[model samples]
Target: MHTLAQLRAGELSGITRLDLAEGLTEFPAQIFDLADTLEVLNLSGNALSSLPDDLHRLTRLRVLFCSDNDFTELPACLGQCQALTMIGFKANRISEVPGAALPPLLRWLILTDNRIENLPTELGERPYLQKLMLAGNRLQSLPPSLSHCHRLELIRIAANRLSELPQWLLTLPSLTWLAYAGNPLETEADAAALEGTAHIDWSALRLEQRLGEGASGVISRATWQRNGQPDTPVAVKLYKGEMTSDGSPLHEMNACITAGLHPNLIRVEGRIGDHPEGQQGLVMQLIDPSYRNLAALPSLASCSRDVYADDCRFSAEVALRIARGIASVAEHLHQQGITHGDLYGHNILLNDQGDCLLGDFGAASFHATTDNLETQALQRIEVRAFGILLGELLERIDSGLSDERRKVLEDLQRRCCQPQVLARPGFSEVVRELRSL
Candidate 1:
């Protein structure tokens, strides 16, 4: 975090990154002094509303973040920054995105929790575009030109006004992660779907050590004691109840309840009620301490792909077992009218024996399975994501299988990730293929 004093005193002249968050109300002209060296700029949590027309003087700037500000429009001068690739303006009041505001080399664009109703056609012209997050907006339709973004891998268009899913979006060759919940096109789950869930009061539970946390909530080790039942050790997730990059915590809880129970899924014991602070929470089975995430979350350079440890290696037998477990769970989820939008390896926890437990409903959403065609296509989209994970595991193999088995695995990967959206095999078929291998 760079202070205004250091910047004005020329102490931060050759810095590659600068963060100024002291309730700035206007663009500091002194920022331009480091135009020759600055590569990243963060002015978030400020009151700035606009930027100067000649803001392009920073020729080396590659990333800019102005989130939680009062800007009502995107700065058009951003397009003049030839090296710019990432632009984030989340949680602002911006309503307009002029075509001139987008840089030609753009890759990642985040505009979550804004009032934007439309996007500029120039967005489709960026060939390097990969991740596009526009959730919590008022968009009713997507520009057809976005179909030209063949490199796009992840997109979050949840909590919007759209009434239909675009065909082009479903067929994007590289699209693997997607979330479209809380939209007009989504089918609302019946309230009774949650009736079977056990209801537990917060007062009866004894909270213990912190377990973990994610974007929407924190999980903790706790003990639950029923009136006449023995005490049970469990994990409690207290929701943060904020609008996440994917969507709302309420929607995530709904999807979790609708998903019901499965062997490979983390079991939800009950719904938490009567919280001391009036917060929503879930009571779940505590996973064994021996389990760990299959891989690390995506790194900046990998963009939308998962990153594994340097020494990570899986035998062909273990790889196939992991694949079958994930495929079976995903197939069950799709059959339940749920799409595990974020199906990366990072979301899967596995024991030493390769038994898998898929968790994290943050990016999960409900889709109508009444329409067979739409349902099948949506499931196939997730198959592509699984294919990427399968390929990653295969890449780390040190040759534990026969030539024929390796060939079969490669063939399955190709079929799952085919660009012909609906033509890709579904999760059920994927499970069968893995078993056969």
Candidate 2:
């Protein structure tokens, strides 16, 4: 174990496995000579802009954890680490990944919370690859070649710009868990097509506990079962109340109905009744073991004040995860000409696996042929609320936020919080920029 003083002195020559993660601000370049023997290097939670150019000299390196850095682009030289198996690059400024530059031995590639717009075809050629976590990238489409990875067990492409599900993905034999909630394909036509072809019996769903409650309605947990199959747990949201000074719950139902069945935006099973009390309610899939809301705690009693306070203390990894999830959901909604009137933290829910599922669409609206300036203004207010929530989370964490993340939040605030609704960034633009961040 190297002490703080030893790291500052920067004279560790034979260190094989270096773990300088917590409470570190800078990289100790003097220890670069250990490249010959170092295998596992954990330099996370640091304020570094880039890695040493000679970092590839560690040919024997395997597990490398350098997440939460300011590197705008991954060094091409990283391919030299042929022995590398696991790589963590979460919360960085990387926009494009060079597939040929990744190590062949890579099995677990964690690149969440980055601005990756596309994946290289070469990535699918890695025979040993198993888990590819690209939850928060801006990927509009994936390379069809990914089907080549026979060993891939999990591929988390949750938040992206995908408008449709590729046919090739359905044939992957080893894949058991597939989450693509924040894609535009969640629209009505696509959902119908998927439901017809996938043979997923969604009728046997039963509502469970209420997960969240908002001014417009309440969200609950649901379980769906088919004749001889096991029950599948889901998060179901019920929309209630009439159009108030805040917004209309009917508009939200319309958005969900129009947007269709997406995994990220909380799937709507069906609607109940439209009685004298207004539009009765809606049924949705349930999300369980719910985590704390990233932006703010719900005004509901189910969420304790202490839990909200603890959420405020989220680490950089957690914050990035939430941001990525929101961006994906926003992207999907924007593609469908819909806008979430309340995109704050309280509206977004996280699962135990750190996946974000947008709920409370009771305040959402569709961008029809004519853009309603009043509605747009209300949307901007929602964006501003999201900014305040992000700022509050950062303040509570009491840690240094990278300039990239800070700039992204500030831009969101300035573009969406304006008193004039027309001054706000369109839903699509916000989603794109956030994905890049």
TM-score winner among the candidates? 1
**Model 2: per-residue Cα lDDT over 1-437, one tens digit each:** 56556755766667777877555555666556677788878777776656666667777788887787876676566777778888878777789678756887878777776888988888888887776777657889989888888666446564567876675564454442344444565333234433332222334657677776775577677776657878777655556653222334554555667666565666666665433454346666544555545445432122111135544465666666666666666656655656564455666777544577776654454443245553344344345445545555555644556877777666675655454435667656666776676
Worst 10 residues of 2 by lDDT: 298-307
TM-score of each: 0.96, 0.43
Q: What is candidate 1's lDDT per residue for 213-306, written digit by digit as tens?
A: 8878999999998889999999998988777888888788878888888888988888999887889889999999999999999865577888
Candidate 1 total steric clashes:
0
Off by over 4 Å in 2: 1-4, 8-16, 22-27, 187-437
Error of model 2, residue 79, in angstroms: 0.7
Taking all chains together, the TM-score of candidate 2 against the true structure is 0.43
Q: Which pairs clash in model 2?
A: 181-263, 181-264, 187-259, 234-285, 234-286, 234-287, 235-285, 235-286, 235-287, 295-345
Top-lDDT structure, candidate number: 1
Cα RMSDs of all predictions? 1.7, 21.9
